[model samples]
Target chain A: MLAMRELSVGFAGGLALRRATLSVARGERLGVAGESGSGKTMLGLACLGMLPEVAVVTGSVRFDGGELVGAAERDLRRLRGQRIAMVFQEPLSALNPLRRVGELIAEPLRLHRGLSRAAALDRACALLSEVGLPDPASRLRQYPHEMSGGQRQRVTIALALACDPDLLIADEPTTALDVQVAAHILALLRALSESRRMALILISHDLRAIAAVTDRLAVLYGGDIIEEGPTADVLAAPRHPYTQGLIAARPTLSARRDRNAPLPTIPGTVPALAHLPPGCRFAGRCPVELPVCRSTRPAGNPACHRGGP
Target chain B: MLLSVEQVHRSYRMPRRRMFRAPPVIAAVQGLSLTVAQGEVLGIVGESGSGKSTLARLVMGFERPDQGRVLLNGQEAHRLPAAARRQTQMVFQDPSDSLDPRRSIGWSITEPLLAMGLRAAERHARAADLLARVGLAPADMHRYPHEFSGGQRQRIAIARAISPDPALLVADEPVAALDVSVQAQVLNLLLELNLTLGLAMLFISHDLAVVASIADRIAVMHHGRIIETGPTARIVSAPAHPYTQALFAAA
Candidate 1:
């Protein structure tokens, strides 16, 4: 299982993640939904030992029955790709400029499997084909700049799978892609989990987007998981008022927003890490907030997240 | 009568290596003609590489069309000298790349004043004034880009774009970098600015939803051509073109 037990991450700005906890099972896909700075990306980075240098993380981070949160630097490096892998938002920048497409895909193959040059090259071509690239062998010779945004993101996915790791973490992998392409990428991630039984951590701001791909969903607000449950139930009928506001705020069909209706905006901005709100973190903006919510923090109970749309 | 794009066709010839071999050419923009009245908001929607940005750069006078002309208030913009090019400004999608990080927001917004030969103190006062106009604290002038959120940074960018009080502003996917919560704020700001300044705008983006509320007229581009152009209401309700329909379906 992939798990974070009472995990805490703090920075000079303040406590960005406060005693957070969650888990994912084999072949399971968990979607983490939050606002722009709601500690979504921070959680993903913390798991891979890639958190910003200033972040001070405490508590236990474990994968496949081993502790990782406080693992030694050298041990973390070995665990990163061999056991866990991540694909970031911007694939173009993440790719090395000087390396050939083939060399880039062959990296993790060499790093973990220690495959020979010929074998790795052959596997790299296979991965390109699996990701639906045309003329997989030909694309291996091109650099990142020569490919389209969608094609380049596919390459990033190919690299992430090179190690055949137990867990895959994708952080807004399709944000820059066209909708058609984003749908294809999402389908691809689901297929990978089905065929490989790899647990996946998918993070994005779009709830409907994450719902379409995940088995379970976690709603995050101000560095805490405000709600968590089965993806279908939560999206179909959300218990949390903030989640409902997000639904109403979603861009309608045809992308035509109504000026007549007031957009259901989350009232106050997210509290800075250095300045967290008392009671429920969402009390400032929750439309149906109770008076008790502002003075007392709500416990992250699974029952509170019971099945809404 | 704020902006007019007249039959603008921009093309580039492929480099020729042999005398006998003729180089192929690529046409980025076709014979496109449009007009933006004062206080009107025009939207240009298309997939990436569909030349929406090329059209934006052309209107901003950053790229001169190979054929046809661009007129700002009945004055020629393409052939204008660099100083006159300052009359029209642009807000790019990536704020970080658009603004100079080494300098304060105040210096960046006041830059065009220097180019236009304004007195130093006058430029500072005008920039600070524009800052308030954009809903930002004037003291924010001393802050760095990293200190502000994506939406606030875009506000600064808008303040800088309109610092010279240009008749036309071209925002190229200004809110695409922000989340849904913040996209609303920026879109609302643009709408308010249009109503208040009546400034003409050429809003280019891939996200139709973000522009639908603010755009008066919508132009849908596909594969380097504007396939559909009509009022936002008409286009959204009954899109005539297949690409626009596909775009609507995606939204």
Candidate 2:
């Protein structure tokens, strides 16, 4: 349903995404995992043709037989909220504080489906209930502030699904919610994608959340797809040093290690965009940094000198 | 126990909108009690509005409990002398926010020492030593907080917290704001410090995995009360409380 080939995005001096290639089949869920400056969000935005004007983008972004790169503004706008939807990390700020959630959700319906206000509102209530929000009728009248963090996120999800888009790009959708609420939101996303046969692009910094919902995993590090494979396979034995570091660094809920021993950590911070290393972005902090890793960028998915499936 | 709280209850009065109406009371901590022995880490795990932070404030003597007492080394924390109070320090969630951006790292680390009437030169030397102890170079002491990364800033915060050689350290979601890889560095540092310095820690966080990793005993809080408290192994393996089970499942 979605394919990105050699999609590169660059600013004045630095590259945000470098020759990144990714694809998601219909009803498939792909997880893009990366830290603060990894440019995972850039990849998501690029898919929807939402990169800022200052950002120079190249290569092909094909979604449902349409090329998004250099597409006309009117065409992009038509596809943005109607055919390709997005859910952000912070729902409170993403939603309008002054507008009623019903109107907000119904606005897309009325605009795209050309429905009357009353009819769109009725559909909006159904969507609210579909996202598992209780008291859907009364909730339509409430503002974003009146709801809990989880409810607000649910409303955001409802708005994204309002147009029944073929693909949904959820960027860190549950990062701000509590653990229980996050779990519920992930489950809802999973179920919705499965039932609706919608392709999902879940971008998150958290490995656990990614591991929970995604079928395939793409590990991004400093604007590159360092690893891509089945989620279970990659998680069971991560080949890339960065992937291994991320997995080891996470404190598992079930596995209890020695309390006195220090946890294994990736030394050095993620390099700033302007100061990124020439070859492998992670080489500076990688434990098994080869000399060649400093001069030549590794090619292909699961990009690494060391052998990994 | 190195530190203990007995039947502590804390509440805040909401401002009344109407002149004739009485202000409503919201209990932040209700009959909460726990302890941390010497060199033992007691993890306080709770979601937002669960009163875990309120408990930390009460333990640090930042807020007084309306009903019960918070005893640190058999003396009330709020009632302790100025010098004695330095024995218990806190490491906040955001190191950048807690540390003054204008001051040098050395100046920030040695502030507690200066308060204890130490000479300026001695304080500077101690600051350098503290930085080295937290796996940072002594030269980093002259740099400001903004010069360091999130993990390094947390190290600076930890160095400052332990500069006074406090027996107890209350870290309230210290690693919550850091990235995963950076969070591991900070968590490991705390674990190492606990072992090397024999410092007791009250590790408060909403992350169950992180709490289970470092805590000797875990206390699960909900709606201003502790629902369950037990050894880390017991809590992870077989939680008796339904809320604890739910928390584990959620994590």
Candidate 3:
């Protein structure tokens, strides 16, 4: 359904993503995991053809057998909502406060499906119900602020699903929500994707959330995908030192440690894009850094020399 | 006990629609009571609107309870004199907002010391010492808050909070605004402070895993009430309350 080859995004100071490549088969669920400044969001934007004008993008982004890197704006717009929908991290800001939620959900139907206002609203109510919202009709008349955070997110998902896109790109969908509510939303996304057989790209800094929903996981660091494989396999024995540090740093509920003991952490912070090192960006912080890693950049999938699953 | 809250009930009156109508009352903290001994860390875990922040405010004496009392060192926290009230200090979630942008880092760190009648030279010396203890250079005291990264700003905030040498440190989601790697750095700092300084801490956060990692005892709050309170090991291993079980499951 989607193929990205050697995609790189360059800004004034430095490149955000470098030679990043990925592909997603129809109905496949892929997760992109990385910390801040890892260019996870940039990759998502590239897939949607939503990179800002200032961003100098290279290489190809193919969707449904059509090239998207240099596609016309009109064609991209048609593909954006109708074939490739996206749900963002912040639901409150993504929605319009002045507009009633029902109308907002119906807007996509009107634009993509060209339905009348009444028919679009009816479909909107149905979509809301399909997303497991209670009293869907009354909710349609309520504004975004009137609903709770979880409900607002549900409405956002309803908007994204209104057009029945083939692929759904949910970037940190539950970052701003409460734990239980986030769990419910993740469950909703998983169930909807399974039922609809829609391809999904779940991007987040959280490994547990990704583990819960995605089948394949890609570990991104400093604009490079350090590791990529089956989620369970990669998590069970993370190959790259960077990926290992990330998993170790998370405080898990099941693993009780001494309260006074310090958690294992990556030594240094993520380097700024402009000040990236000569070779592996993670070489500065890797626990088992090789001398060769400083001068030679590892290429291909699972971009690490030390270990493999 | 270093800090004790006894049957505290805090409520706020909602805005009235008409002149004749009485406003509705929303109970932010309802009959909540907990204690923290010297050198102990208490974690209060709750979601948004679950009344955890209200409890923090009540403990810090920022808000007076409608019913019951908040006692620090056996004295009523709300009725304590200014000098006595300084025994407690708090670390907020967002360091960028909590630290004053207009002032230098040194000046901001010494504001509490100034209130304690310390001289400018002594305050600066103490601030320098604190800055070093929190893993920053004394030279950084001259820089502005914006010059530092998110993790460095949090370090500065922690230094400021500990400069007062308060008996209890109320850290409300101190690492929530930080990245994962930076979060470990800050959490390790807090744990080190708790050990070295023997400072009692009220560590409040919504992330169960994070709270479980640092806190000796944990309290699960929901709808303005602490539904469960026990040792962290027991709480994580076998949560008795349904809400706690659900929270663990969700986590």
Clashes within 3 Å, all models in order: 9, 0, 0
lDDT of 1 at A87: 87
lDDT (Cα, tens digit) per residue for candidate 2, span A1-309:
899999999998699999999999999999999998899999999989999999999999999989999999999999998989999999999999999999999999999899999999999999999999999999999999999999999999999999999999999999899999999999999999999999999999998888899999999999999999999988998999999999999998777888867888889888878888889888889888889889889886569876553
Highest lDDT: which candidate?
2
* Model 2, position A125: C-alpha lDDT score: 99
In model 1, which runs have C-alpha deviations exceeding 4 angstroms? A52-54, A72-78, A254-262, A283-295, A301-309, B12-26, B80-87, B96-132, B137-147, B249-251
DockQ per candidate = 0.36, 0.84, 0.80
Listed for each candidate, the true contacts retained, as a fraction, are: 0.30, 0.92, 0.79
* Model 2 docking tier (incorrect/acceptable/medium/high): high
For candidate 1, lDDT tens digit of each residue in A146-169?
998889998998888888888999
**Could you give candidate 3's per-residue lDDT for residues A221-299 as a string of tens digits?**
9898889999998888888888888998988888898775798877767887887776887888887878988998887
For candidate 1, give the lDDT.
0.81
Model 3's lDDT to the true fold? 0.91
Please compute the TM-score of chain B alone for each predicted structure, in the order given: 0.92, 0.98, 0.97
Docking class of 1: acceptable
Q: Compare candidates 1 and 3 on lDDT and give the better one.
A: 3
Q: In candidate 3, list every pair of residues with a backbone clash.
A: none
TM-scores of the candidates are 0.86, 0.97, 0.97
